[model samples]
Target: MCNLYTSLYVAISVSQHISVYSIGLGPTELLLLTLLAIILFAPRKLPELAKALKESADIIRREASGSAEKSSVEDKERALKEVAEKLEASEKQEKKKRRFF
Candidate 1:
């Protein structure tokens, strides 16, 4: 199948050093492909696309980090609140016992 051939070509290409023939295309082919893509997409469009991709990635990263920080803060607040409530309840019980005696 074509996939098998492609995988084998990739494996041989990566394992071997940069030579004249490594079963498939090489850096020259990559350069040609890049040039073709640039020609097709236009140089002006590339920067805009790259900037959009970068901004989207940054937004995703920032949101993930923000949510994680928020969750951690919430967890700490809940723990402290629970501890305070327990202490207050214990103090109230002690006061009641003292008054009863």
Candidate 2:
């Protein structure tokens, strides 16, 4: 019975340690990954790749901004048309009221 208890305790302790280890990594892991990537790609190619990525990101941002601006302008035009229609309808109603009175 004592030997069984000892074995169970050792197994539980080892499992707990493994769970803690597998939980997640921290900044050291990220730094190691960056270092590995740098070593694999070298310094010269990294700058060109980074520039291309930045350009692509800028293009996407510009397109998104332009679409947002265009939609806002369309929204404003629709709102103005709605206001004009409402004003015309109210003016007609006023004329009818005057005729009735």
Candidate 3:
């Protein structure tokens, strides 16, 4: 039901952000990629290209570590609040059952 969709939505949203700052490439793979970029582009252009890339990476790193952590903390708080509400509701039901019996 609705809860399943909600859970999936939250999970997918979080995971998309999890990879925002990373390509998941290992050191060897990253080395190869850099080598390929060097081969494909001119040496003179490489420094400018690298400077732009570094700036972009710094922005991404800052966003991921700082803003993302804050949002993730809020999401966790929201989820925990939901669970607490559910538990409280269930406890109320149990109390009603006891009173009826």
List, in order, the clash count of every candidate structure.
Answer: 0, 0, 0
Q: Supply the global lDDT for candidate 2.
A: 0.60
- Sorted on TM-score, highest at the top, how do the candidates line up? 2, 1, 3
lDDT of 3 by residue, 1-101 (tens): 45444433433333343443367755555556556665676555555566666667678789878988999999999999999999999999999999999
Alpha-carbon shift of residue 78 in model 1 (angstroms): 1.2
> Per-residue alpha-carbon lDDT of model 2 for 1-101, expressed as tens digits?
45444433443333333323344745455446445545575455544544564566568668989999999999999999999999999999999999999
Residue 1 lDDT, candidate 1, scale 0-100: 47
Tell me, what's the RMSD of every candidate?
13.0, 17.0, 17.5
What lDDT score goes with residue 29 in model 1?
76
Full-model lDDT for every candidate? 0.62, 0.60, 0.65
TM-score of each: 0.55, 0.58, 0.45
Predicted structure with the largest TM-score when compared to the true one: 2
Ten consecutive residues with minimal summed lDDT in candidate 2? 11-20
Pairs in clash, predicted candidate 1: none
Residue 86 C-alpha lDDT in model 3: 100
